[model samples]
Target: MDIPAPAPNGVQLHAPGVAALREAAVGLETAFLAEMLKSAGLGQHRESLGGGPGEGQFHSFLVRAQAEQIARSGGIGLAEILFQSLMEARK
Candidate 1:
């Protein structure tokens, strides 16, 4: 069954069962990993050979995409734990 959830634009959208929970869990894990990567200087520019303003401007997007890919590829197991927690909370 679909459950009504609020979207960012204030629209009511239907969240479809476990799939939605899994997606959300993965997203959360991605965000967490992205932040961790950022803290670890994954996308930081180097003083000597930096890509300049453009690279600085879009480094976050690259980091986030990388993090998403990692999450989708089984990640550090955070997504699975989060998915299980979400499933338990929904009950």
Candidate 2:
């Protein structure tokens, strides 16, 4: 019997050639989601609550983190479609 080589750390076992492309695609999707979240008023400070200057300064970071989490959780299928398109374009 023959043994297969071990996969590299932090690399996808499948479609290693497109790992970078996949990451780029996911990043694009994350940005898109972040913008959408911002438009939807996510992480927005309420006038009544009055989180103040600190909240205003950190709201963008909160929105970005939420967008990243959404993308990691298979966000709206955008990343997968983007990855497929990238693979096709590469070929």
Candidate 3:
């Protein structure tokens, strides 16, 4: 989607691309959070003793789940702010 720049006049609250923009924003936030979770998980000693190949295999799934949950719970408000900014820019 070609997200336009903000207009001098203002934003149109009911723009056609608003929904898509919001969805994209949420997706971006979810991916960002998932990457962060993955990075944080990398520091743990999961491969020391009991951890097997399965632990490494399922790490991405776990991170995705946690990131989705976090996003559903307001997600640092990045999605909302992004949605608004995109909407404004589309004006």
Locate the minimum summed-lDDT window of 10 residues in model 3: 1-10
Pull out the clashing pairs in model 1: none
For each candidate in turn, the TM-score is 0.77, 0.78, 0.68
Residue-wise C-alpha lDDT for candidate 1, range 1-91, written one tens digit per residue: 2222234233223445767887888899999999999999998887677577777888899999999999888888888788767766776
Give the residue spans of candidate 3 off by over 4 A.
1-15, 42-45, 48-51
Top lDDT prediction, candidate number? 1
| Residue clash pairs of candidate 3 | none
Which of 1 and 3 is ahead in TM-score? 1
- lDDT for residue 13 in candidate 2, whole number 0-100: 38
Q: Candidate 1 vs candidate 2: which has greater TM-score?
A: 2
Candidate 2 ranges beyond 4 A from true positions = 1-17
Best-performing candidate as measured by TM-score: 2
Q: What is the lDDT of candidate 3?
A: 0.70
lDDT of 3 by residue, 1-91 (tens): 2333343345554567666777788788889899888787642446466787667767677788888778767787887777777766665
Candidate 1 clash figure, as a count: 0
How many angstroms is residue 64 displaced in model 2 relative to the true structure, after the best TM-score fit? 0.5
Predict model 1's lDDT versus the native: 0.77
After superposition of all CA atoms, the RMSD between model 1 and the true structure is 8.5
Q: Write model 2 residue lDDT over 2-27, tens digit each, in one string.
A: 11223344444366566677678779
Give the candidates in order of lDDT, highest first: 1, 2, 3
What candidate 1 gets wrong by more than 4 Å, as runs, is: 1-15
